[model samples]
Target: MTDENNKIRVLLVDDHPLVLDGIRSRLEDDPEIAIVGEAGNGEEALQIATQRKPDIVLMDINMPVLNGIEAAEKFAELLPDIRLLMLTMHDSREYITKVLKAGAKGYILKDVSSSEMLIAIKAVYQGKTYYSSGVTDILVNESSKKEVPLTDREKTILQLLAEGNSNKHVARELDISVRTVETHRRNIKRKLEVKTSAGLVKYAIENGIVEL
Candidate 1:
């Protein structure tokens, strides 16, 4: 716990300057939460986290030098005590699943209300997991029965596809051949009963693989 005078320190990590300003503005009013530092990318976030040891880290997912999921895994290994809350426009199942597996304490969309964002931050700081309404709905949907039980690899491909990744991009990320990626894509479509990429994306959204 923070000292009586010391508020819960928070580190904001995002690539957009406007977003950083907006989030800082929304959070600065709360006396209980202190905006300790700001970082533009995951690398910077990790550096600031190491130096500041803030109570909560508001992290963005897609970044230039290092993506949020990769950095989050590193942070989990390096700073096990720190709390990480994803604050990004992306609400994909792959994004959520990877980050949570990397040890994030909460997942919230960038569009969330300031009130809900604050609640998520507080919950994570208190060592509890919190997900925004849309994210929670995804988790619930994932737990229920499904017609197509996708393999782990197929789900990964579907997630990348839903995130707007091309076959080449997915292959590179997973360190697989383009031919292998195409094969998996075909298999995924066949199993899910979706023919087009657009249809796959729609299925991903409707079935909680990605958020609309």
Candidate 2:
């Protein structure tokens, strides 16, 4: 049923052993996918991925040692050819955007059917991005937004905020006055139509405003 030469080698990374086991069992039924390795945390995942060089990795968002986003960033830097797919229970836009920015090629909810999972794996392995139906609304809403350009300074300041830096801290780090940082923050909020700092951070992370 599977073309051995065309098979996609997959690595599963989740802190929960039961979830990993379920995913492995479901995917094992498909001849086109081969479970090459498994890891319980992001650090272990990095080690396993480096050793196995899997064609695709199914990464979970929340882990103990290292989060999925961090691991994805490292993997992208170290193994650019390896496709990363986020497999998580969270359907939040903030989480989705973070993973995408970290270099994940696909995002699928844990409740996805076995068939859908297989298709997503195949799609990401072929270099196409995929999102589950549950989170498709977020993508659609984001796509409908009108583009608003930002200045270089504003962009830099926004990136710092996205990385969880406070306004005062960002000002100090950027060698600018606190008033200047506040001004830039207001300008960024106006441009993005985001009323709060949290909203701005979410937008920045989702849009890949700052390199992880």
Q: Each candidate's root-mean-square deviation in Å? A: 12.1, 11.0
lDDT of 2 at 23: 96
lDDT of 1 by residue, 157-179 (tens): 88887665778988999999999
lDDT of each: 0.81, 0.81
Residue 88 lDDT (model 1): 90
Tens digits of lDDT, candidate 2, 29-50:
7878888899998899889988
Query: Could you tell me how far off, in angstroms, the CA of residue 128 lies in candidate 2 after the best superposition?
Result: 0.6
Q: After aligning candidate 1 to the native by TM-score, how far in Å is the CA of 193 from where it should be?
A: 29
TM-score of 1: 0.66
Kindly report which residue stretches of model 2 are placed more than 4 angstroms away from their true locations once superposed: 1-5, 142-144, 148-212
